[model samples]
Target: MTASEPGTPRTGPHRAELDLDGVRDEPTFLDRCARDLALPQWFGHNWDALDDCLRDLSWWGRPSGYEIRIRGWQRFRAAAPETARTAADVLADAIEYWAPRDTPLTVTFDDQE
Candidate 1:
């Protein structure tokens, strides 16, 4: 049964929601993820570090899955296209890594203004 199916226990699909309303740089992006996602102290504030943390969310709790929803990134993408691409690539890799695992990972970008 799917997660939303009735009678299914809410063991989870733990979520981390990030609102980047005014953020437009790599530092801010990393800082936002580290702060909003409650990344561990070992997080090194870099793309590699972000990738590592996204792949290992055991610290966030052992949920059935994970969903990272990002909103208000149009401005960031417009301001820093390269950085946004890199961030997207890392997130995509994390999703792929978890797709075949028991605990899946998903990232959604909300383009609503």
Candidate 2:
């Protein structure tokens, strides 16, 4: 799964790329998500917090749609399969939450490093 990065600024309104090139644990994964996704300041940096933020991206003015591209995730998955599954599930849930509301949220994976 891959998509070209838009020419827009790396602010809250464009696709957020989380490059987990070396991330191998939940803590690092959370930190990478916070930085790459530009999560809100009030973000609690936890699984629950991540779910809440992804569900409501008001911080980004709740764009008409949202896309998240995950790159270099192979290492993380191999290092910690369980956490990787949980992370994928959370993202999937976020997509489900937005689909019914008309605001599509797509999560793509790009492990071709």
Candidate 3:
């Protein structure tokens, strides 16, 4: 049965992809984020800025219950483990930021490349 089928439960997370191939610096990471999420021009390309935009994703008009998957996550991790950890933490923060509303937003790092 399809997701829209009446009997099918709406229990799955919406999937989005963020490519991190050859992204080894802050600027590239920010650019990738902006492109992946189609963030606004006001994004400041910093962690706090990222957090702000992430929390404000209602502008995308996307429904609740979504998990954005960062593809080639291992590339980022290999190039800069600390930065990768920071990204993961920020995503976790975003998840928490929306949890109170029962939106079920989250992110997953996929190392499959």
lDDT of each: 0.85, 0.82, 0.78
lDDT of 2: 0.82
| Best candidate (score: TM-score) | 1
TM-score of every candidate: 0.87, 0.84, 0.80
Model 3, 1-113: lDDT tens per residue? 12134553454455668899989977888889998878889999999999998888755554546668888888788898888888888888999977876456877777856
Query: How far off is residue 47 in model 2, in Å?
Result: 0.6
Clashing pairs in 3: none
Clash totals for all models, in order? Answer: 0, 0, 0
What's model 3's overall lDDT? 0.78
Off by over 4 Å in 3: 1-14
**Model 2 segments beyond 4 Å from truth?**
1-13
Top candidate by lDDT: 1
Q: Write model 2 residue lDDT over 1-113, tens digit each, in one string.
A: 12224563343334789999889999999999999999999889899999999988867654557888999877889998999999989998998987866457888889886
Candidate 3 lDDT trough over 10 residues, lowest sum: 1-10
